[model samples]
Target chain A: MGRVVVEVMPKPEILDPQGKAVVGALPRLGFTQFVGVRQGKRFELEVEGDVTPEILAAARQAAETMLSNPIIEDVVNVFEAEVSA
Target chain B: MGRVVVEVMPKPEILDPQGKAVVGALPRLGFTQFVGVRQGKRFELEVEGDVTPEILAAARQAAETMLSNPIIEDVVNVFEAEVSA
Candidate 1:
């Protein structure tokens, strides 16, 4: 098997309300040095077969088509590895 | 400066509706092998000062207090590294 990791985030120019909210709350939580915070999503998957270029391509396509919002978000990164037996 | 990486995810027992929606959309996007997909958050921060244990601790605390929802989510991982000058 193989494992896939995908990270999704809002486009840098877009305002991240979720991130802003977290940043705003940091001071109350005793985090005085924290100046900013941005929130995004990570996805990990265990695929049921050998890792191949075709599989990776399909996975990337899947991410773009269904897993992420192309207009408001960006696909930050995608990584894959073999699952240990 | 330092860099902080935080990954947040739903508790394993909690049903991830966003993940489910992604899984449902995969098939339509021509990804037949994808049986499941879970989504979470990743935060990468460039701190403005040297890397220290105290900074790392504060960052973790901030993640717990404001960056994550403790009830329905779990802090999957937190990592820190010194930034190259």
Candidate 2:
């Protein structure tokens, strides 16, 4: 089966409390190299056959409409999952 | 500034209700081309300078310890966020 990967992230203007919490915790955990953190969502959409252009198009549409909230998030990426991830 | 991207996904053996919910909703949204779905997390860790090897290593460590639940989730990828994503 082929898989499509979609990534969605909070918009720059939006406040991400989860990310803030992570950044706050990281320093205490000794991961001080990181100055900031932003959390997002990743999805793998599996198909029965090859991931055709049509399938990618549909996945992009789904990523935009259903996977992410346009008001607060942006669909940052929509691509074929070539790697095992 | 530079960013490191960390991806975490549920282990194959683990049940992903969130993914099942998405797969179930796809058909209703006219996205029937997809057969299955898996939901995961994406984290962007921002640093003040270039994403050095040390920063990546720290991100990897954080991904394993703080970003994902080792019991049920896997840290699938840890890399520099080369693209705008």
Best by DockQ: 2
Every candidate's fraction of true contacts kept comes to: 0.58, 0.85
Question: Over the true interface residues, superposed, what is the Cα RMSD of model 2?
Answer: 0.5
Where in model 1 is the C-alpha error above 4 Å? A81-85, B81-85
**Model 1's chain B TM-score?**
0.87
Sliding window of 10 residues with minimal summed lDDT for model 2 chain A: A76-85
In model 1, state the lDDT of residue B75: 86
- What docking class should model 2 receive? high
DockQ, all candidates in order: 0.61, 0.91
Writing each residue's lDDT as its tens digit, candidate 1 over A1-85 gives 6778788878888899988887777777667776666677898765777657777778787768777799998887788844443
Clashing pairs in 1: A42-B40
Q: lDDT tens string, model 2, A2-61?
A: 999999999988999999999999999998898889999999999988999999999999
After superposition, candidate 2 runs with Cα above 4 Å error = A83-85, B83-85
Per-model i-RMS? 1.6, 0.5
